[model samples]
Target: MGRAGPAGAAQESSLRLACVWEEPPAMGTCFGLPCDVDSRDEDSSQTLFFHPSTYGSKIRLYESCQVAERIDSFHDGIIFTSRPIHLHERVTLKILKKEGPWHGGLRVGFTSMDPLEIDASLLPPFACPNLVLQGRTWAAVLPDVCGEEDTVLTFWVDHRGRVFFGRQQGVQDILLLKGVPVRAPLWAIVDVYGHTKAVQLLDPTRLCGDAGEPAPPLSPFQSDVLHAPACREFHGRPQGCTEPCVICFSHETSALLHPCGHASFCYCCAQKVFRRSGLCPLCRGQIQNISQARLGT
Candidate 1:
């Protein structure tokens, strides 16, 4: 948990977040949608170093979803991309907010070397082989998609190199990884997961245990765990059910289009996709609202 490079150095708080991870907010045209990108500064603290919490509330819904305060780690923690993405072209990333109190996590996408020493937040979750869990979200053509709430993670890379992923965990839209490999000079991977335990080192139950005990519920990285189990002795190649309704195939959808993160749709084609073009018919991206998910009784 100590990599530091881009002059970061700032780590103290096993857990404490109302907001305090400053520096990196000159972002306009984003949520406003339609800018290119300039102002340079890259360093990902070597791998993962995001702490955002200077007590937020510019009243954000997603002025465009750009969360970067710092991370250039000599250029590997890669962050920010309002433009410059070609190959199979198709980009999207949004998870604004959800599940706080710090369990913190990170592991976003895109990286084609050029100084990316590959430390995907300490990769170990199955050594990469494409993907398989979309409920808790974590399936990639081989890059791994994940979420706790407030999700979205679309990418593209077809012509034949095959790298397609569509995120959103709990209620569907899990098209996790499809061809895997557009590996080029591509960069922009927003990693930020959870973790910050130290409530008095979690009182050993209260002096040796249990005294009306409670503290035990951080909740956030769900998919349970079972990654990288194929371990090809010297080989490769190996590896969805109940999912229909990209807008009527006979019903069975639940709805979820909020912020351009497709959850498929069913409520009469999600109002017939906003009467036709609130955008997001797959990447038109621009649909401020349309949610309704929850059906797992």
Candidate 2:
């Protein structure tokens, strides 16, 4: 060419650079070959000098450049744009960074699905779906045999989404009694977690009704049991002694109220006594509930 223009010169420079960067190594190239200027050596030198075809193909370089440009454009959201992810698509998020103290780390954002929704379709097939039966308790279809009837049963779903079911008696309650009929709506089921199973039994007619009267006040005896003595004595003696007495007090001042009725014990003693017999340790009376009895200061 007599004189190349600026545009042609720039294109030539780019082609040279691409060829240098993308060319493959020559085949049959020997390392440490002596060049003593013999006939064979002269012949090889001539071959190397005149073999312009040995530069391989320059078109491959252009192809590689084109491919690299396409990749870069795709990564920058220019060539291939991404579609929005749908909610139904199962997504997982990992925590790359967190805020707040170690004891209570406040999660700022999750790398995957953070706050998941509690929905029926999201639950497992074997999972006992969460059902609110009465009060603040939550019920689930029993995964196992609870009792004679399996219509409404108690089941627990842990934080990790594991399902468990049983008739833990003192530990759990039946959703429906033998003679009683549960008239709860299907939509009342709220929580699927295992913490509190008490369901808020609602009546559609009483949706706008006035607040009901407060529960009846406890009797003095019931109040005494409610504020029962500690389970253990100050000296560590068991409060229930040998019998499961209702009003047994521990030395530590912590009270233990029997689950069934007006039975009480100290915290230390009650802990020991309740282990063997959940019932009223002394009177053989059935314990309906067990709780820490608080004495009036």
Candidate 3:
């Protein structure tokens, strides 16, 4: 990714201050208690990014760790904010990219567990039944339409510990999950799964109605394949022709297929397959795009 020069940095600083005077919308009441509590003074003083240590193995952090992307097989991709958000502190993110062969969309919510205190190796591969079943975690798969690239989402936890998420177009929001035990500080959690490939966390100062500007494009140099095991076939001649790419068997396995989520073709072989049948060789699922799966950093 290209590093911003002094001029670019100055511009971004101005943009960040542009919305400081703008107030967030009033939140809904939960169990007769006021939900719109303001802690912007404390929250805005610190930078927000994905915690470096407590993320799943398939996840990658980028843009100074403000963006999260999934790689490899697409499962094992979960992340949490670096710090716990204050009550009604709206957390906003934009869908940077999406790919398919898989159903469902992004999942967002809150968790009471401190990320620093949890073991990353023990983190589940998913959020729905995997993490949520463990208890203090609450999340919901977004509507399929929300899977579209550039979709801006804002979510927060209310005073009653109910979770609500919605598009940033207006003040409207849908209750995602409830019964969260908010006795402890709550950190925002996101599952970059299925069709949702990459996401970028926006500044809390950028409110729903305030910023009309579109999400910024990611750095073209950003890489896929974070922490991926070195491909044996890609490095040297296949020993006894074992585990060669399912297609040509001449090179390392590359391009990952959507829906089927299979990684069985090199870039060249994938292009050939895409041109010939446009279907996954194993499952025969329709092809969407050809590329090794990884996101952000």
Candidate 4:
């Protein structure tokens, strides 16, 4: 589909195809988010254009291709087409500018009908534009910064559309937003396994589809864990175990005090205690240091 310029001339010269194809929303449909679609004229005769077949029936047309127009605006503008469009679909459109290059770029906002129904693949490529998804409940760095230290920004969205960014560096250094409900489908699952940072979109059928159960709200504790830094080593494993206070039975009569104030215990006992209380069984202290023990004989 295409947008008509002033004087009824469709400017094909300025048409730059978007790298990714977006689904358009249907006519007169409530987007369920804060945005506005501007008409070419005072009269609302011009509907945002899109091919109903390829890009999906629903599409969100940006009121102006220039990013500054949508930034910080309480409402965003989009054209929703009523067809399922795939990646790589090409289309042409016009973007307005402020008469200078200093203030022009594309910006778009997103809010999921079901926050839990999001698919990671559907998320705009890392940093394409600022995204406000799940009722403005959660925010993440553009997909491009998936694995960088301090690159992720986790925040909570209140019912009033206000977002509270999470704090960094502390026991609660979690990057996942708190109090957000995982509705049904799990949109993004980030796996940080052994030097690999992979994000996978869940299948609707296995997650929020017919067979899936509604997701529950994230518990305060779970939120903390999700945002914590990646733990390189298994906390209490025999190999590469780094709890300094660990008490080694091989040293018949001495106990160690981990710098982080955890009780020292052997590999086997530490494992057992971690399973039971997830704390130092002997002193009832929270385990922090995970270094190996020195034999004090």
- Highest lDDT against the true fold, candidate: 3
Q: Which stretches of candidate 3 lie over 4 Å from their true place?
A: 1-44, 206-211, 222-297
Model 2 backbone overlap count? 43
Query: What is each predicted model's overall lDDT from 0 to 1?
Result: 0.32, 0.23, 0.63, 0.26
State the TM-score for model 1.
0.21
Expressed as tens digits, the lDDT of each residue in 155-192 for candidate 1 is 55554544455553334343323332332234333333
**Whole-model lDDT for model 4 versus the true structure?**
0.26
What tens digits encode model 4's per-residue C-alpha lDDT throughout 85-159? 111121111222111211112222222333213332253322112233213212322222222322222333333
Q: Report the Cα lDDT for residue 152, model 3.
A: 81
Error of 3 at 159 (Å): 0.9
Residue 136 in model 2: lDDT: 18
* lDDT string, candidate 3, 1-297, tens digits: 112233344433432232122112222222222444332334455656776456777776655467777865556778898777877877888888787666555777777677756767799887655776676666776776677887888888887877788885556788766666554567899988767888888985653345555445664544433232232222223344324353333466556666545564566767776666575543335777766732111
Better of 1 and 4 by TM-score: 1
Q: What is the C-alpha RMSD of each candidate to the true structure, in Å?
A: 21.2, 36.3, 18.1, 22.9
In candidate 4, clashing pairs total 42
Q: In candidate 4, what residue range of length 10 has the lowest lDDT sum?
A: 60-69
| True-vs-predicted CA distance for residue 55, candidate 4, Å | 17
Model 1 sits at a Cα RMSD from the real structure of 21.2
